[model samples]
Target: MPAVDPRLLRYAKATRVFLALSVLIGAGQAVAILAQAWLLATIITDAFLHGAGLDDLSGQLALLAIALAGRALLAWVAEVIAHHASAAVKSELRMRLLHQVVRLGPRWLTGERSGELTTLATRGIDALDDYFARYLPQLVLVCFVPLIVAGRMFAADWLSATIVLVTLPLIPLFMILVGLTTKQLMARQWASLQLLAHHFLDVLSGLGTLKSFGRSRVQVATVEKLAAKQRKATLASLRIAFLSSLVLELLATLSVALVAVSVGLRLVDGRLDLQTALLVLILAPEAYLPLRLLGAHYHASAEGLGAAEQVFTVLDREIPATGTALLKANRTIELEHVMVASPDRDSPALDGLCLTIPPGRVTGVVGPSGSGKSTLLAVLLGFTRPDAGQVVVDGIDLATADLDDWRSQIAWLGQDPMLFAGTVFENIRLGRPAAAEFAVRRAAGAARVDVPLEQVIGERGNGLSAGQRRRVALARALLLDAPLLLLDEPTEGVDPDTEGELLNTLPAAFAGRTVVLVTHRPALLGLCDQVVELAPAAVAV
Candidate 1:
């Protein structure tokens, strides 16, 4: 990646504004640095060489104090801007990234790791703190202060300026060489972190299954191995950072010492005056300071740079086309020759399938594992688009219909429903947030949700049993009351008694909605007005 990506400016408006302010601040800081150096040099020369007393140097002393104060104030102001800019830029990038992900939809997200994306939005974006707070500000100064300091030095004394100009490039030249290696190390460390996050999340999500299979210990060992690899990569990056810092410091110190020696010799030989010599010596180090600081902070900012590249990759995905047509009520859903492919599967999920369901009726979809039952619902829900053929609703092509408007007509309940940490009422109200208490209670009663409304539940409904959670989710779906209801294996993982009770309630709860049910139970199929069985993706349906 380039030291600064132009996409950052394009994707985040705050970055553009920050850069503009940085330029103005940088110019002011450059002027302040020169004034302070010149005033300090004049004060020292006047006092030492001309035997100037306090009264004679009072005005110069006051001017020097003001210059020093201005430089410090500018530094503080730059710091404040850097922090604020860092926060604003990070927030902007994260929001853009999340919005882009949503635009790409669940189809695109299926291929990505949730943990990795979570890390990118949180820790990955956070890494930019060093980039904005320290590295970027110094980068602006490197553009302005160094050149200004060197120009003043050249006008005062050409020989000392020549030494500074010749040695200045050495610091950056070495920094570039070290940075190449550091970049590779940082990439490895970042990759390791992402892998660790992905694996850790997987372990947590499947911990119960691992324990049931007596393989939890195996997963623990695997996690330990990944953690160790991440640790090693991090240590390697730190080692390179420390080594580069040392190299930069040594080059800068030697360059400044060379200028000091040259200036001292010329002053002793009467080739240079005390004021000019003092100015040259003081300003020599100033020329090297920005470059050295930049090299040091580059390592600190590398992790954030790597993360930004990944975020941009996600942001660059092509969003599926949508349309402006509003979906009307009493519309029929028709799928003609639909085929959906999966990257990880050999065959398509839905292949050359044609189907239709009339408005306000329950349709049951039954199939074996790996068949297109769930894929059919995904097609109707607009989460997965067909590679060939079209899904039409009331003569409007779903591909051409506005997805938000289309989805507004849908109430979906997945086999594994997600529940946040909240009370029963809050979880049920998610389907229809504006629903009154009586309406909520009616839906819960229809769905057979016996839990108390004020009873608190853990995240993912951890406090409830599988059957209770499904009932809560069903209540949510019932509360939605959208025109279309899509339920995928709602009775899955429930006991036989609970499953029969749920089946008894579903038909009445599904009344007055265009319902598509994906399931394997014969009892549930009996409740549907029409039943369709899908074959494996290898064969046409």
Candidate 2:
């Protein structure tokens, strides 16, 4: 794939007005610089050699001053325009990427690392700044400025202009040679970053487990090793970038030196005028300036390109549109020859096992750890699409259904509920943002979550006990007013007394609705209407 993604056209479309203005302003600056160089050179040659008057000198100086001021003003305006355009492009692309991921569904995102996704959304999208702000404008200037400068140079002295043209290819040639290494280095650097992200996120997610087992020191050693590898990869990338910059700069400088030497020889030989010699020297640097800057930024942008590739991989993944009939709220579920595989493993989590969830019944799913309990729940929740067979809900296939609508009809309470860092009011209201205060209170009461709604949930609900978090999650789901509820390990941490009270209170709230509760607790199972056992993979296989 090319470094510049064609998909970036979405961002390019975001601020067309500002982009146009930025280009115009940038070109204006080039024009100003060129004119000032021309005027000052002509004025110097006239006053020193041609014996021009002081008034003529004053007039030329005034013109030069105006050009300089205009260049400064245009440069400032260009910066303003470029900054806003870059910001708009970044914001639009971030939102677009997020929307793309969400629409593509869990099949694409579920198995991916959160930290890598964070890096992609932040630093990866930022690479477009180079593509749009630096590379693009320079690309434009590369066309206009160099051509204009070369034409002016040729007009002054075709001999020196030809010298510049001949040596110009050398810069990109060496840059290409250096850039070959750049691509390889960037690939390695990105891999290292992804590895670090994977490790870091895994560690953070399991930090509590590590502490409980007193193995945090072991994990710390592992993290240090990973960080060391990342540092080495980073240095390797920077070494290539610096080398690329050096090679490009050296080539451009050599070309300018050659042009200067030719112009000097011509002037000393009495075949060229002083003004023409000066113009040739000045315009020579202008011709190679854009090319030099492009080389430098290209290296910086390659890392971003690597990250974008990963993001594109997610967006491009095939999420089948099965055209299966939508499963809406009758609460009846039938699993026929259902099989779901672990994304990071070879074996199926739920093998070709059939089961039925009776409509509007409080059914319990019980199994040992790694015995396909949670996987079955994920499949029910539409997070893990089964590799084989049908998950039929209310006589409709889960695949073809309008997922958002199907999921909206469900109230879910998972083993570890996701609680954003905010007041409990916000977390509970997540089920329905427009839910009234009294409605929220009613749901909270039904879940037996005694915590005040005004209390803030710390990061990951660290402020609450395990049972409290589960209760809050149950409250949130209840606030949805959905007809069917899925609860995973709902009463695992609650005391037997609280668990009994919850089981008794919970069924009343469901009235005519259905509930599927998962738990290993005898206390919770006793209260359920039905109990289903999931055999181990060994037995199913």
RMSD in order of candidates: 2.1, 3.5
Please name the candidate that would achieve the greatest lDDT relative to the true structure.
1
TM-score of each: 0.95, 0.86
What tens-digit string does per-residue lDDT give for candidate 1 at 342-442? 66677889888999999999889988988988778778878888999999888888888888878888899887789999999999999688999998998
Off by over 4 Å in 2: 1-3, 10-12, 15-30, 57-59, 104-110, 126-133, 201-212, 322-327, 331-373, 386-388, 391-397, 521-536, 539-541
Candidate 2, pairs of clashing residues: 324-400, 326-401
Each prediction's whole-model lDDT (CA) = 0.87, 0.79
Candidate 2 lDDT over residue span 1-541, tens digit each: 3644665554347656765675687678778878988988988899889899988699898998999899888767666666677788778768877977776655566667778788788877787676655665555566567767887888878888898888877877887787788778887888777778778878987798899999999989998998999899889889888877887898899889988887788789998889888878877898999789878877766776676677667666665564545666666799999998765556778888688888877888888877788778778877778889988887778887877777778888877688889988889899799999999999999889888899987777868898888888888988998888888887767887888789788777877777787888877776678888888665343
* lDDT accuracy of residue 240 in candidate 2: 81
Predicted candidate 1, C-alpha RMSD: 2.1
